[model samples]
Target: MKKLITATLFATMMAGTAMADTTLKLVEVITSPERTETLKSIVGKFEAENPGTKVEIISLPWGEAFQKFATMVSAGEIPDVMEMPDTWLSLYANNGMLESLEPYLKDWEHTAGMTDRALELGRDVKDTAYMLPYGFYLRAMFYNKKIFAEAGVDGPPKTMDEFVAASEKISKLPGKYGYCLRGGPGGLNGWMMFAATMAGNNEFFNADGTSKFSEPDWVKGIEWVVDLYKKGYAPKDSVNWGFNEIVAGFYTGTCAMLDQDPDALIAISERMDAADYAVVPMPKGPAGKSFPTIGYAGWSMMSASANKDLSWKLIATLEGPEGNIEWNKRIGALPALKAAEKDPFYAGEQFKGWFDELADKDAVPTVMPTYLEEFAFFKDSLAIKTTQEALLGDITPEELAKQWAEYLTAAQQKFLASK
Candidate 1:
């Protein structure tokens, strides 16, 4: 009778275990059909491997993602796991909204295979990792061979001065512009790249935590942009052009060159002929230095998540070798997994430019001051406003430089004080 009772209790416990439900809400930041579908497929595999743990994907459009996510968080509708761009990762992690993955990473089998940079990408000021990077986005210059040949420019510009000359030459073509300037939203990249290149050093702060935008070299970089705009090197209408407009400008023969990340290739490849264009390392500054920035997107677990272990399992599967390669293949981003560096999918002529940038010892890879939550404000608002003013001849480069220095110094002081 006792043996029978034990068996019945064991069966009841087993049934209870099977009845427990753990649902993970995963928010996808990129809402493209292909990417969303690929994520669903990966989630399906994860669900199969870990029965009774279901993942529900919440898709957010890239355009409205930030505002919408802010609203969701304010509304207390936090997900179990969410796509975290490096730009937003620090902000979220710093605010204690993210679950630090340090403990989980120490025992994670996949952590051993991740690149040092990939592991470091999600680190906060205190060096605690809150996310695992899925992929990297690095800048390279894409140029039109047909336009170059027509402009009599022998090759891609090697220096900022040469870049100006090439742009001028290209602009001589009727109804064509030299550079596909991203003047609208997401235009901070062009501003930062040029400013850093001109400054010789990409570092934003000095030893005492002072900002560097007002430095003479950085001013020169801002001057270059202003000069280009006043000289009609870029389309006048491009002052309001964002990613779609800029890519269309390049692919439709409206612009001769564009400095962009590998992800831009996915869209460009669909519209432009391969033989007509090629990518190269960004042009150096007068100081013979080029600071091409790199950014990444990763997966982070919300601190509010009730199923941390299961959510981590989903992250591991998605960032693992097979899944990383598959996702990057569709996104045209560089896989953050170190082993993926040798994947055959990235071993193509079309990918040569990014590879060249990565291999170029002279080209320094840079990331912006994403640690500051106000950085998004600077990126999406201040930079755009001042740059558009400079382009319109409403502000001199020096004035623009001073404005940046004053604003960033204040932000830097606040950030340091908080620390």
Candidate 2:
């Protein structure tokens, strides 16, 4: 009996030594309760499958992540793996801080299941892929079915004219507005989509790097939003509504429709019943075109990681078809793996709208200007303030367009010069 006990103790010690041979530190830039739990679950499964591997996750607050990550890099305390946002991709990849995943992906069987677009999303300016995006945050229209019924609208609108008509009818309901306008922080996506659809094209920059906001079609797009606000199709107070307020407005039935990403589904599902709400593609312009903005955050490996193969395995397990679907289920984003879209979970009403848009093949998928260093300031500060001003009638749409054109031109010049 004593020998048996000693043998067991020896085995346990060997197991510990084996695990100590490989430990991976992963950083998550977008910190939240839901994302934390989801990461834990994914890592837990990876650890179980690979007995000698251990992963430790370090989550950083979204607002301070850039500064904090820079400090870590300066200190040489880089993690083995990290959640890479699009805006930060050029910075890290260009600096040689991130590992190129092309070689690994070439040998990875799981890459076969991922979407071509997702695989290309991680490419650096030199065209090397350094990250593998797990999911897409693409825009779709979320409408309150009950409100539509009460307003006597037939169904979700397919054209801009139908959208305005529906909004007018829905606003006629006592104490309810037709649309929720995001006129506050992070409002740029809404503005861009509205302008893109109205213009029937989504080009932002010319070959010479000049901005298209000053163009007639894009100006008309901005005018449409101003008209909607001034004509009372949207609530006056909505001029101050950001993400939370607009989401609340939709779920509480204060607004009939909201154009948002799939991530909004998480909050909507918590407060509203399944039957009360549904999602649909963004309405098309007079020229029959629609553009929905697409953004993604992905997993990347540090170039200095001691165990590149094992680190990539962890990433594969997280972004594989099974893992991608499971992760997106909790985070409320669309899976980067195309096969995951066929899963039963995506067949529900809440997800059908986005699926329909993807199927349409004509609705353009738009990407923001993440290559510019000043993009954060432009998105979080200048765009919000100027758009709010335009909504308030403080500036004409043409004036707003001219302001945007000047700013973008200067920013583009700076970006090019730095390159």
Candidate 3:
């Protein structure tokens, strides 16, 4: 009997030591000052509670995240866990670069708190879950409330026509650009987002993944935008506006409207009230519906990781209901955790409204699979160059569309080979 007791005690001792000695290396592509500070604080809290496991964090900027991740993957300097971009997930997952977490996630309790849409976005078409999604990148319309009231617009316009009309009214105001847009990178810069907004307008990439940017409905849509700019409703520098420029333009009240991610609003100082600022669904165009870009940002554990179990535990902790809510609060993020999304931190109806509507993909397609072609869709193409030329008044829209069609045809063929 004594021998049996000793044997059991020895086994228990070995197990404890094994768990205590485990370590995990984690990487997060830090994007902003606020996010960087939050990352440090979270790591400290995680380490304190999770004894025996030390997380070696390596911060990489988002601008260089993809290239860095690619290099590490080739060299096998792969961390135990990584936070990947929405578009890049498909590229990694398709190549088997990431471990499938479906089996392990099956038994985890934290999933109950996650939003269904977030789950769909984080997983593959085969129902294989890859990364645990952290936040939403849903589209929203940010209108200057002061401008709205002065224009006699009760609130944001609900339909595309009304939106255009409101912009016309607002553009006449002193020192205000009715809208701010992205251009220079042209098609490369805004095609996907244009797909979403056009989705709101019931426009789309066809079954073959090709687009006719010059179709009457689509042409009309672009014409409206062009007219808006030609009339000085949109800033001339719009051709060069990137994510950074748009955010600054909106916050400074230089632009009257912006179609951007939800976090853009949350980035504003909290002292501002919903009355002064609120988000509306992307306006519907003549197509009777509008689409908006919904991006996923998340982390997945490596299958070949030496410390798979420990890495999963750390991942589970960060994506857990409580942890998700806290991290989301510090940033302007909507929690992927369904329960966390409902927490008091999200506040009233205005914020949660789109999360509820858009999560189901009723308004638009749900879970745009992450892919690399999305980045190259418009790169170095004639359509893009022509658009830039039009912005410079060197070409006509007709000539621009003709050139774009040619570039898109060739680009699509190369991209379709992999599909």
Candidate 4:
């Protein structure tokens, strides 16, 4: 009788211990080996601080993350927390999948330290805090100093005319191209930047909810990129190049210039020498202004999370001052906290171009039309196909502009009507 009682008590104790432990599921959509390492390090500290909690990380490749995450949610495999990009926030938040972080933010110790821009962007969806943004991604020009010197170019271009002149000069060099054009996936930002700069404004739609992409200046802008490729200024094989290909092109010296967000710096800085290249603000247009695209990503909790309080605690740990700085260091984005900008890491010469852009009166940081529910499809599917067609000479630049304008107009009008 005594032996049986002891066995039963031992079984009960094990069950109680198991019940005491909690495991939170974390999904990272922008998965990279370095990013994963940083995330794990931060999460390790969180786990250490909370004795009875563990976080299970699920990383999905960025290319297929949108669709894969959506499918997972639909199939009832939702995570406790996720890395939410600017483009995917509305889709999940509007569909009631995300838990508003406003309540938690009010009580968080680091809330006061967050930059106003971070809070503003976090409230992008329905004016509620569905996510706590970690950092900002602003586009800037990266130029190969070695390639420029070889081509006899004096410095980075400040104007569109100068940009073209430099490209022409660089293309004359043996087996060299001027621009690492991302003509495949993730090329929409380049298209938008060029069009907005040429149009002298970052306005996407007019008073009547019509897209401005079909305007003459916008058409000219699109044609200019097409002409760059046609004139052999961009690599012939670049029509199918995506993010990785373009970055490779820049570092390998196949191309002289690349306009990319700061996240790219993480990868570029790894393989290239600091003195061999330099970052600069995107060149201006005829109107003496440049519209560089700005984007952000954040940590969000799911509505279905059973451990809401614990999930919030994890979020706070990741987005808090020290954790945020550590994450952004690995992620290569501008910190979202006002205080973090003062960190010595951001004061380096590589970050000078982005800071200069922010200070420049003529450098407009343009936000994408990500509020539209159909924007993901428009950007990942419709835009890619049409832009590729234009790049390949299968469709004229005017046709490409008109198609984009019509699609965006419908989407914008639908969004406005729903409001």
Residue pairs with backbone overlap in model 4: none
Spell out the clash pairs found in candidate 1: none
RMSD of each: 2.9, 4.2, 5.2, 2.3
How far off is residue 357 in model 1, in Å? 1.8
Weakest lDDT window of 10 consecutive positions for candidate 1: 14-23
Candidate 4 stretches greater than 4 Å from native? 1-16, 19-21
What lDDT score goes with residue 360 in model 1?
Answer: 86
Worst 10 residues of 2 by lDDT: 371-380
The sequence of per-residue lDDT tens digits that candidate 1 reaches over residues 1-419 is 99999999999888768645678899998567778998998889998998777888999887567778988999999999999887787678878999989999989888888988888777744688888888888989999999999999999998988999999999999988899998887788788889999888899887666778788878888888878878999999888887778888998999999988887788889988999999999999877889998988889999999888888899988988888888888887888888887877788898998888888887899999888877766776788889888888898888888898888888788888877
lDDT of 3 by residue, 1-419 (tens): 99999999999999889868776778886376777677667777777887767788877765456567667878978889887666666666766767888877889987766778778777743467878888876666777798778777778887767877888788777777767676643223344444445434433345565656555555555555566667787777876665667767777777778876666665654534566666667666555666665666888877668877777777777787666777777766667876764466577655754665475344563334234344323433443566667766777655665555555545555567756
Query: Candidate 3: lDDT of 91?
Result: 63
Error of 4 at 249 (Å): 1.3
Question: What shift in Å separates residue 368 of candidate 4 from its native position after superposition?
Answer: 0.8
For candidate 4, lDDT tens digit of each residue in 1-419? 99999999999888778755789999998888989999999999999998778999999887677779878988999999999988878888888999999999988888999999999999998999999999999999999999999999999999988999999999999999999999987888999999899889999999888999999998989998999999999999998888888989998899999999888898899999999999999999999999999999999999999999999999999999889999999989999999887789999999999999999999999999888888877877788899999999999999999999999899889889988
Please give each candidate's TM-score: 0.91, 0.83, 0.78, 0.95
Give the per-residue lDDT of model 2 (tens digit) for 272-322.
Answer: 999888988999997788999988889999998998999999998998877
Error of 4 at 280 (Å): 0.9
Output the better candidate (1/4) by TM-score. Answer: 4
Tell me the lDDT of candidate 2: 0.86
How do the candidates rank by TM-score, highest first?
4, 1, 2, 3
The per-model lDDT (C-alpha) reads 0.86, 0.86, 0.66, 0.92
